[model samples]
Target chain A: MMLFFKECRKILFSLTFLIYLVAVIGFYITQFSHDAEEKISQPMQGCEDYGTIAKEVPELLMPEAAEGLVTEYLSGYYTAYPIGFYKEVKLSEKKSAKIAEIITEITGISKRELDGFSDFDEEGITMIPDGNGGYTPVVKEATLPEINIPDTMTYERFRELMRKADKIIGGGSQYSDDNIVGNFSLVPKTYEDALAEYNDIFEKDKITGAYARLFCDYMGIIVSILPVFAAAALANADRKSRMEHLIYTRKISSVKLVLTRFSALAATLAVPVILLAFIASFSVAKLYPENNTDFLAIPKMSVGWLLPNIMFSTALGMALTEISSQLMAVFVQGALWFGSIMRDTELTGDIGRFTLVCRHNSLYDRNAFMENFNEFLFNRIFYTVLAFIIIALTIWIYSEKRKGGLNVIRKNIIGKSKA
Target chain B: MEKIEIKNVNKYYGKKHALKNITLTIDQGMFGLLGRNGAGKTTLMKTLAGLHQKKNGSITICGIPVENTTEIRSITGYLPQEFSMYPNMNVYEALDYLGTLSGMTRSERKKRIDILLKKVNLTEHQHKKVKALSGGMKRRLGIAQALLHDPKVLIVDEPTAGLDPEERIRFRNLLTDAAEERIVILSTHIVGDIEASCEDIAIMNDGKILWKGTVSELINNARGNVFTVNVPQKYLSQIRKNYIVTGMLIQGDYSTVRIVSDAVPDLQGINTDEPNCEDAYMYCLYQNGCEVQGGDE
Candidate 1:
């Protein structure tokens, strides 16, 4: 316990901890604070916009998905999220013919017409006169072609054809079963839908519950990756100070020393995030004074939602840094954070089992979060367990380092560098 | 207490053998290991501290085997050849942190830190940040940290390498005081430290011990082999090509060079001189044919 506090004090005085604090606070301020300044109001009977919701209805989805497939077929390339980053997938003429055949089977459009439309100037960025001498670039949104699915085609059959089209586009496309409904099944909200969502904030969320989701959404982005710097810096601190030998020769067992240091790092890095959680919950309470608010809503939610990200990144950072004696942790965690956040374009609630940064970017989407609550729980639990596993590996690595067991590895690395 | 017994210890860093079939017994007192850089003195020290594993050997420190690392570590402390604490921590804070790592209780840490700070003569600088300390002050703090737990053995590698003459003497005196009750192994390339502080010393070169005995025994062994010869400046280079010139005093066109040769030098005005630790070490290295080139430096 004393060593834990000492290690925490050491990290608290480090420049990396300061950088971590500034990053989380800066993210909360820039991304979430101003956007949520105005409190949510009751929905009136007749507003022009009530926002959009995704629902799986066969009639609406069939035409829309068919039109989307035809449009991408005409665009000469497909946009896919193969591993999370946006990928523009271009198919060979042979594979393009396969997709055209699937499009024909679903939309009753001929394959020759799809090939003929290739030279057509479809919607894209076009340069226009800005009234000055310079040209202004304007984005023209892509309009899905009007393609009608025959009445003889079943919705299940249409889905299978879409699956075939996704496989042709190299998977992770909107046509895949995992994403088809989320992508093409959206419908605008009705008056009752909007009003019910507004009341759910009061009855279900208790006002602060809704705001807590938004808080984690914004804080999760920076928290997932920023903690890597702290973990890596802490892991490298002893050697940087030329104190590795002095500390290694001590009477403390490697298990106790490694675990104490890890706990301290995890706690210190969590300080700013937990502080901001309190501030966010208090802010929501102040905003909705007449209603009840769970003051611990953000704090509780952050523990389940954001804490895994903090622990996972930090443990992996320490393990990688200890194993390689380099900042490989930063690159690996950064890639995970990036891929988890970019796995889907719809930001409100589309949690995957492996999403490191599970996001619910809106205040009123309590239902969306609740719908995927089980998967969210799994993701958090998986990361939490993974953090421990990696930390155990870190303890082993540290023990080996103490006993000069890593000299063979270090020598090989040095020998390779020299060669 | 049982002596630290190391029997036929061999270690390797990859294919290159670091400590080759080394065997020694170190008892309570100041024991000096004199060697040049890369002589595996640090390796031997680390192995004794349980910070390194020997390939195939047995080591028992104070009746506990080195394989029992936690027990060995509890009884032993190590200060590496190059070390400093977290630069931002004050002197007292630095010592306390190390004491904590040594598994001392809070009150125990406080008491030991106070005693060590006074012993190392750094009590006045207790509140100063480690970054603000001088090189010698940092070295003293290193010693303080190593001795924080009051271990049975303290292995300090090259403790006075970069200290000024005065600081070196003070550091050596501190080591001598530390050796009163426990074994303190001081490893260094500087032979003067061993001659001043150690009753027993070992000379190592290329991971092999060339000689191990008392300080005077080593000097006596090299007595007849050490000679000072007056040679012309033009012939100095030629003389160096034949012998290991340990020291030289240039005087106009002539120079008095201290050379270590197995036999009498075939030069004018050659006189046998008493061998100091440095001359004895050079003579030992030259007799063992271990490339003891000491000219023009």
Candidate 2:
């Protein structure tokens, strides 16, 4: 227990720990503080954009869906997210023809006619009279032939056909099942819709849960990348200070030593995050005392939503540091955090099953979170389990190092660097 | 009551042999391991410290097999050649931390740390940060932390390698005091350290033990073989090439040179001299057909 506290003190006094604390607190105060305040004051107006949500009502308007497909097919290129990475998938001639056929089936527009839709009036450098005084050069907008959707095609049937078209285009087109409806069905929220969402926040989440999700969203980003610094520094500290042999020769078992350090680092890194959670909860409570905010909401969300991120990052940092005996975990964890941030496009919805950072940035989206609640639960549990497993592996590696089996590589690396 | 026993212990770093068929017994006293750089002295010391496992043979500390590392480590204290503690910690804090690692209770650690700081002459600098201390002071603090648990065996590798003459003598005396009750293995390439403090000494080279006996026995092995000759300054280079020169002093037109040879050379003013540990060590390496020149000592 003394060793654990000593290790904690060592980390707390290190420059890396100070830098990490600054980054966490800086991110909280700068990014989320204003959002918390704004959320408290913004009236429940339905005109606010919640981004494009997929609606159950389907309308196969030829101008929106078909024109989009025809334009992409003519260009011979499409943007897609294959395996969660943005890729510009250029289709071959055969796939392009297949897409053209689907476009004709949906809108009764031939591929040749679609290609001939470009009508350009390019008389070079024409000047038109400006209302003020001088004349300004104007480029006239091109007009294309109008295309109409077949009356016999129902919205559901057109959707099925478009889904097939999306599959043929290799799955990142606007017509894909996951993206087709959201791409076309963006409607402004009605006052009734906004009132209903406000009522949902008041009744289901009770305002604290809503704010807690936002807090987790911002805190999750910081926790995912910052704790790694403290962990990697603590793990590599003994080797850097040339104190490994002295500590290894002590009577404490490797498991006990590793677990103590791991817990100490986790606890120390948790301090700033837990404090932020309290401050955020208090701000929400003080700003709107009539809402009867749940005081436990932020704390509960911090543990339930954000703790797994801290655990996984810190444990991975320890494992990687033990294996290489270097601070290589920072790069690996940084790359993982970057990937998670990139994949989170809809912060208010679609919580991924395995993302390191689970973002729900909105103040009130109980239904979207509830839809993926089971997967979110599984993700958290899986990360927690993986954190423990990696910690166990770290303990094993530490023991092997103590037995003088794993230090050969580290010594050779150090030797080469010195040479 | 505590003694370490070894039998044909061998250690290898991949294909390279580090410690070759080493067998020795260490009892309660100050034992010195004298060897040049890469002479397996550190390898042997580490093997005994339980930091490295031997590939073959067995080792036991006070009748407990070395494979039972927890028990072995509980009673052993090791100060590595390149040792340091957390630099941000003060001398007392560093010792307290390591004592915790050694599993000493709070009262035991507090009581022992106070005594060790005083014994290692670090009582006055107890509150100084480790990085703020000088090299010799840091080495002394290393000793203080190593002895915090009062283990039965203390393995100090090159404790006086970088200390000045005054600090070196003080460190030797401290080690001598530590050896009164437990086994102390002081490994160094500097012969003066062993000569000043150690009674039982072993000389090693090329991962093999070249000689092991009392300090007097080692000195006696090369007694008649060591000679001092006064030669002209021009003949100094020839004398260095022909014989193993342990030391040399330039005196105007004449150079006083100490050389080790099997027989007295046909040189004017050649006289047989009493061999010290350094001369004996050079003579031992020469007798083993090893190169003896280009040594710092």
Candidate 3:
């Protein structure tokens, strides 16, 4: 174990990985600062934009609303309205209240509770002004708007309208007065959402330069692939150098070889990744001290998040290095990063979530992990076992290679087995 | 005492029979497994070194069964044909690292590295990376690493194939020094190397040993059959067409060539010289005596 650890130290503590750590941390800090809003908003001469895309629309719309959902206005907006807003918003308070009452009948929350419940601010309720631009008394507010509704109208019809609005919002088509095809008038709310409206009124344009883009692209490539390559190179050191024959001849069993190699690979990533994380966390903390974010709060960043994910990533890299040639393993890891970045969206935060390498990116989402510890535990257990399965697959492939088939592998493992 | 033993070894590659009904015992001192390339020399060496599995055979080294791979490996040291070391590692480091693989403790490995570095005369270049070393230095380093754990059986496959004549001679001398009490099975196609150092030699062709015994015995059999004839360049083509030409030396207008024939074709005053391992190997391969078990596709 000491010898194995020594080897791990030798492989992991290289100047290249250290440089990569610094470069990635520096790149993220200098480029994607926590103050993206401040830098993005400041250039309009400190003129505060009301309802910035992030502050207004995202906060106002239901958390489920897609970005730019209120589309009849801005280039970024997806549709004129959210389905619920289209159906619920245009109606008079009495009709909306009635609909709310019906919804509460099934969901068990009262109409009053449903009316006031906001996805953003728990206490705030949505309200519409009367024609005179005045607040109406609740007693008088109880009367339904004179829109023709059949006595047979059901909650199902209401749901169908909501579905249509959702489809429009999701479809990413601009909704204008000219394009309105049916009973729905334009969602009277600003076609340009408050956020879009605010950005138009006050938002500044900040263009990152070619050099910055170049730096980011280079650093991104290095961070995603270099350590993966190092791990791969280290993994096959034994096999490439024909040390397997000598090591297998010793007291070390084949199992030890597999395990030690794995540990070495994991350790290889651990040093650089942890260092990168530490640098990143520290830099983030330094740059955004006002947010009171604990960069390496032992319990939160280290244990709650980074450590377990790092372990998983390292194990994943090692297992990959074991099964495939070193270069292909690195390439697979690189492909996973590219696949994830391309897939990046609000819906899939870590687009590479499907990949073995990126499965742990959201390992412990504080908001979700806390609410569903058991579910999170289930996923962790599943992935941990999955990592081992990958390890087993690697071992099976390697053992077959060792048994003398002499198949062409992109990178030969010349090092001792990880076990 | 026999240091290594093989019992009716038979090995195959898919449908191709690489080794067929082979049996041999190796005692302490240098023994040569001589054959042309692809004559199953590597297969036999790897099986003996516990690198490759035998389809039907039992190989034992120092009373340890070849089936017990780890045990056999611990007692055996192998330098494969393609003698490679970690390119990034320095001479001493590569030796130390390989020593660790052979189950040597760090201190033990360090001590052994020191001694072996001197033995291979690479002590001065201990800090030089294997990649930076010349071909001769790298070969020496390969030998040094193989001898690190002091194994009882040392198997080197084609060790001197790509060496300057001086380096090859030096490497052979190093092998001779290390063969004190261990069984050294040197596998190569080079007959002169075996003839110079190896007391016992085995001639293999087409996956089977055509002849095996002392070199003197094989040479005595082919003594009178080899004849040297001075022929004009015109008759050189006719002689090659009729007789099995072993060697030729062209000087001025005449060519002195060695041919393997039952009797002199014409009384042209031909002289005869003693056959060396090369002569013996060529004479043994003169005719397709054994039909290659598997057709050479």
Candidate 4:
């Protein structure tokens, strides 16, 4: 325990950790703090925009999903989020025909005619300002030739066809079962729908639950990447200072020493994030003086949603740095983080099972979050367990290094890339 | 008595044989390993300290086999050839951190650090940051850290390599005091360290032990082979090419040269001179049929 504290103190005083803190706090302020505002309002009649809500309406989803599939199939490439990053997959001829078959099954449009339709309009959702001084999403329609679903086709068969299309694109497309509703099922909300959502924010969320999700959404991005810096710096400090032989010769077991050092790195890196959660909770409490607020909401949310990311990233840094070198660890983690951030198209709760940063950027969509809670739960727990597994591997590597057993690693092909 | 024993210990760095078929007995006192830079002295020390593995031979440090690294590390203290502490840590803090890793209790660490700091002559500078320490002071601190655990054996590799004469003398005296109870293994290419302190000395060359005996035995072995010859200055280069010249003093047109040879050189004013540790080491290497690159410089 004393050794852990000493290491924590050393890391807390290091320049890298200071940069980590700044990045975390800076992200909180820029991405989340500025977004702390009055979001819910009673919908008024005759407003230009009431809002948009994702509904699993077969009439609305079948046409849109079929259109998206045919257009991409014609283009001979598909966009996917297979692992939380955008991927452009050019499928084989057999797979392309499979997608065309799914499209023909849904729209009664033959693959030959789908190919003959030279161009299709691009469609997306636009956020427009309503009269209540808040933005509401309005979907834009494509002007391709009209396509209709058969009356005999059931929603289940349509869903099955969508699933086949997702499979054709290699999964994680908007047509996949896990993401279809969040992607192609958005419909404009009626006044009553807006009022119901507004009431859900107060009655169900109790105000802070909604903000907590938003806080985690913004805080999660930086924590997933920043903790790597601290972990790498701490893991490499002994060698950088030429203290490895001194520590290696000690009576302390390698497991104890390496585990204690990781504990310290994880602890120090977590302190500021948890504190920011608390501060965010308190500040959100001030936003709704009349309503009851869950003061523990952000802190609890941070522990569950953000801590796995921090631990996983930190463990990766330690294990990779121990296995190879500090610079490589940072480079690998940076590339992963960058990839994860680059293709995160859906921010209002499309949490995938393998999403590195689970995002819920809205302050009012309690239903969207609860709908995918199972996957979100799996993502967090997997990373938490994986973090420990990596640390265990790190301990083994460190013990071997201390005993001169990792000569192959030290002589790796990276040319002086080993510690 | 607690001692280190080696039985034909061998080590290799990949295909290159480092410590080959080595054998020796080191007891509780100051023992010196005298060799050139690549004589595998560091390899032997590291192997004994559980930092390297022996291929086919056996080594036991006070009955603890070298393979049992945890046990060996607990009882052995090693100071590598190049080392430093976290630069920002004060000397006291650095010692405290190391003592904690040594499994010393809090009170034990506090008390042990005070004694070790003063013993290393860093008492007044205990509060000073490690980066601010001079090279000699850092070497002293290195010894202090190695002794912080109070292990049964201490292995120091080239502890005096980059120190001034004064610091080297102080460090040698410190090691002598440390050797009063436990076995101290000092590995260095500098023969003066062995000459000043060790009684049991071994000379290694090319992964082989050339000679092993008391200081006087080594010097006595080379007594008749050391010759002092008066030669003209112009003949100095020829003598150097023909024989291993250990020392030289120049006169007006003549030079008094000291050379180690198998028999009398064909020169006038030839006399056998008493061999010091340096001359004896060169002569030992020469007698063992190893190349001796010796000169006045």
Candidate 5:
């Protein structure tokens, strides 16, 4: 217990921990606190511009979808997110012909005409005379040609064809099943739909739950990447200061030493987040004093949702640092965080099971979160288990290091750097 | 009666043999291990400290097998060649932290830290951060932390490697004082350190112990074999190549040189001299067919 507190003090006084705190507080003040101050419910007047929900309608307008395809094909390049990384996939002639064939089926345009369609339509602009008697050029808006769609094909059939097109494009194009719908938006919700969502937020989420999920959404992004810096610094400090041999020769067991450090880092990193949760809970309570908000909602969500991310990142840092004796864990965790943030397209909808950062950006639509509650539970629990497993692996590596079996990590790192 | 016994201990770093068929018994007091830079002194010290696993040997520290690292570590305190602690911690805080790791009670740590700070002459600098301390002060703090738990065995590797002459002498005296009731294994390439404090000395080269005996016995082994002769400056290089020249002093047109050879050369004004520990160490390495060079100043 004394060792654990000492380790905590060591981390608290470290510069890396200071950077982490600044980032956490910076993110909270910049991204979350403003939202907490604005008490706009979905049914209120300005809700239309504030929240955008995913409503997967059973319709796909052919002209709109076809025009987007033609524009992408004519541009000679496609934007995709294959495997959660942004990739610019350039197609061969054969792939371009395949896309043209799909475009011909949706509209009456042939492959030749589709290829000839320009990216923009030019409009003539008149010159404007300045007060100094010199002529200034005024540029006109350039618009693309609008295509006409036949009424014979249904939306479902068009979706099936687009899915096939996405497959031919290697699965990350905007036409892919995962992203085709994101290119379009649902019609604005009616007053009834808005009122229903507002009621759900009040009855189901009980005011604080709605705000808690939003807090988790923003806090999750920072938590996913910041704890790693602290963990890596703490793990590498002994080696950096040339203190490993002194500690290794002590009578402390590897389990005790590693667990103390791990718990200390995890707990310390979670402190700011827990404090933010309390502040957010109070803000929500003050906003709706008569609504009888569940004050425990934010605190519960912070622990249940955000704490897992902290544990996994910190544990991973410790494990990788123990194995490689380098700060390689930071890059690994950074890549994972970047991928999760990029793949989180449905920010206000169902939480994905594999994403490191779970997003619920809205304070309404309790039904979306409820729909995938099981998967969200599994995701949090799985990360918690994985964090423990990684911690156990860290303990094993530490023991090996004490026995001098793992000195090759340090030797190889030093040798390569010196060489 | 605490002692460490090693029976044919052999250790290898991959195919490179680091300690080859080593066998020795170290009793309570200061035991000096003298060797060159890469002479396996550190390997032997780490193996005894339970920081390295020996391949084909049995080591028992006070009747506990070296494989039982927890038990061995409980009674051993090691100060590696690169001595450091948490740089952000103060001297007293660092000692307290390590003491907690050693499972000392709070009161025990508090009392022992004060005593050790005074003993290492670091009481005045106890509140200073470790990074702010000078090299000599840091080494003294290292000694304090190692003795914080009062282990039965103390293994210090190259303790005086980079210290100034004054700090080195002070550190040697500290080690001598520490060995009053415990086993202190001081490993270094500085022969003067061993001569000043150690009685039992061992000379090692290429992972093998070349000689082990009292300092006087080692000196006697090379007695009558060391000679000094004043030669012209031009012949100094040639004489150095022909014999293991331990020391050379230049005066005017002639260079007075000390050589460890079996017989005196044909040079005039040759005089036999008493062998010091450094001369005896070079002669032992010469007799073992190991490459001998001038001391690394």
Candidate 6:
């Protein structure tokens, strides 16, 4: 342990990780082009346009008769369903139809023929009115021809079916009599009809948050992990030059070597991550004031959520690097951690949840930092344990491999004892 | 005095035999392990250093089993065949860092760093990164680093491989100086290094040592049987086919050849004398049932 500490001081403390800190911090703070721009282009009115179509169809069909049903359906559908950008590329009609059938089979909706619909143009979207003044979809509202089925199908399947029906509806012009009677003049007659629609997803007036802040927090995660790469480079620096044979043969044990190298590397990652977390928090609070920014709260999240995760990631990287080629090991682990950050939203269903990179980061929950210091401490403990476990596993694998090759214990003691 | 004992060492890298039935004992003072490339010299060194495990063998340095690698390593300094050091570190920094790893205190590391820097003649470039050093300086650095902890045993594999003749001589002198107090085992394909510096040497091939003893003993053992013949250049190949040609030199239109024989050649008058370590090395290799047929037998 003493020897490990000594080595860490010399190799890990060298000015190697400085570059990584800058890069990670730079990446996070840099302005990213977002898919939200598409939302911005369409505006908040488009959301209302969708809501308007659902509400007005039945009212237009029966002027004074059935107001409650149309409003209820409109409120229930729009309020209940959350909107998100679909990631999958547009599928062929046949593939889309097959997927739709599979979904409808389990959804209990009668298979409705999609005669005319436009997937792209929001203007093309329209609702069919029931003779009783309730709104229904004009084309196949559901893909199957009805049998009771559960609604467990994913949103992806639903969106795919919607897209398929939209293509057919836009290609031709056919509305059932029920839909024809409720046709809304406020809505477009074709795909080009609704040029200006209101967005109901998240109101533009109620800015949820600044993207720059999220961008900065993301950079903090990357910066904090820089030490790991620096440590890895230093750890293998000796090995690359053939000094490992000499160094290992010294009083240093394989386990000590592994730990020392990990410490240096992990510390290297921590320095920048911690600093950037504070900076990001401060920047968000000061620069983007419209969002009621909390600079003090923001820095806490960086230390809490981002730092530990970076350490764990760096530990994992160093451990692999110890056992394998340094370049390849760092590359694989770095890419994995990066992927975890980028895919965090998709993986956890919430961008705020702990990703592989953010699992133990000290810079996570800003609110926890100020309001519940104990909770903040608790969160730190929770993530620190998680990070420690991963780091421990990395050390175990590394030492085991360095002792001989992989499966050293199995090969040396176990096999020998068995024999 | 400490001794390194290799007992029936057999190493297998997943069934590809590397070292086979190797048994030897090395004591304090200079020793040479000579072999061609891929002849298991490195395997033997690695096994002794505890870098590689032997399938069946017990190696003990100074009565401590080689499996007690950490303890053995504490007293042993090894320079590998292809040594590498941290390129990003300057000469002083690399030595200081390695010194710390070898269990030297910071003050002790600092003291040793100065001594090593001067010893290797790298004092001027003490602040220069390792990557900027010349090959000779790097080898010198390898030597200095290996000796830093003042280890009881020093194992250097192919130490003079890429060094210029002057550097090789200087390094041999350094090894000879260090060997005065420690067990220094130098493995190399060069016969001159063994002949000049090693008091005792072992010649290994095909994973086994064919012969081992002092250079004088190796030469003395093959003394009487060597002969020289002056033959036409055209018939040199024919004579070589019939006799083991140990040395050859073209003199005018005639070729002078040295060969080992139990009896005088049938061709009549020819001068003959004692053989050197090189001849003894060739003779020992051939005598150990090498597939290469002997001419002038």
Model 3 per-residue lDDT at A402: 54
Q: On DockQ, who's better, 2 or 3?
A: 2
Candidate 2 lDDT by residue in tens digits, A265-292: 8888888888988998888888777677
Candidate 3, residues A1-419, lDDT tens digits: the string is: 75587576557565545654576566556654442223222223333432111221212222112112221111222333221111112334554454444333333445455433233222224455778988654321222112223335454553444445434344212222212211222122232343343343222211221112222222333344555655666666767766555444444455666677667655555454445445544544454455444444322322323233444544556656566556556666676556544432221112121222222222112221122334444444555566577667666666655555443342344223221
Query: If both were scored by lDDT, which would come out higher, candidate 3 or candidate 4?
Result: 4
TM-score of every prediction relative to native: 0.90, 0.85, 0.68, 0.93, 0.83, 0.69
State residue A285's C-alpha deviation in candidate 2, in Å.
1.2
TM-scores of chain A in all candidate models: 0.86, 0.75, 0.46, 0.88, 0.78, 0.47
| Tens digit of per-residue lDDT, candidate 2, span B1-297 | 488888898999999999889888888999999999999999998888888989999999988898898999898889999988888889899888888988899999999988988888889999999889999999889888778888899999999988999999999999999999999999999999999999998888988888889999988999999999988999887888778888888899998899889989778999999998889988989888888782223
DockQ, 0 to 1 scale, candidate 3: 0.27
Whole-model Cα lDDT of every candidate shown, in order: 0.86, 0.83, 0.58, 0.87, 0.85, 0.61
Docking class of 1: high
Q: How high a TM-score does candidate 3 get?
A: 0.68
TM-score of 4: 0.93
- DockQ for every model comes to 0.81, 0.73, 0.27, 0.78, 0.77, 0.46
Q: Candidates 1 and 5: which is better by lDDT?
A: 1
Instruction: Report the lDDT tens digits of candidate 6 across residue range A1-419.
Output: 55556555655445565566457655754532231122223322334332222223432333221121122112221111011111223445564555345334434432243222222133334787778989876643322122332346443443343344334333111122212222321233222222222121123212213222343345545544555566567656666677667766777665666666666656556665556555554544453356544445445545555566566656655665655555655676667556555441212112222234322222212221122335335544655676577667766765454345464444554355446
Please state the error at residue A137 of candidate 1 in Å: 11
What would the per-residue lDDT of candidate 1 be over residues B1-297, giving only the tens digit for each residue?
A: 647888999998779899989888888999999998999999999999888899998989998999998899888878898898889999999989988888889999999999999999999999999999999999999999988999899899999888999999999999999999999999999988999999988888888888899999988989999999888899988988888899999999999999999989998899999998899888888888898777844
User: Which ten contiguous residues of candidate 5 chain A have the minimum total lDDT?
Assistant: A46-55
Pairs of residues clashing in candidate 5: none
Instruction: Name the weakest run of 10 consecutive residues (lDDT summed) in model 4 chain A.
Output: A410-419
Q: Which digits, one per residue and each the tens of the lDDT, describe model 5 over residues B142-230?
A: 99988989999899999998899999998999999999989999999999999999999888888998998899999999999999999
Candidate 5's C-alpha runs over 4 A off are: A42-190, A325-327, A413-419, B230-235, B249-256, B294-297
Q: What CAPRI grade goes to candidate 2? A: medium
Which pairs clash inside model 2? none
- Cα lDDT over the full model 3: 0.58
Candidate 6 has a DockQ of 0.46
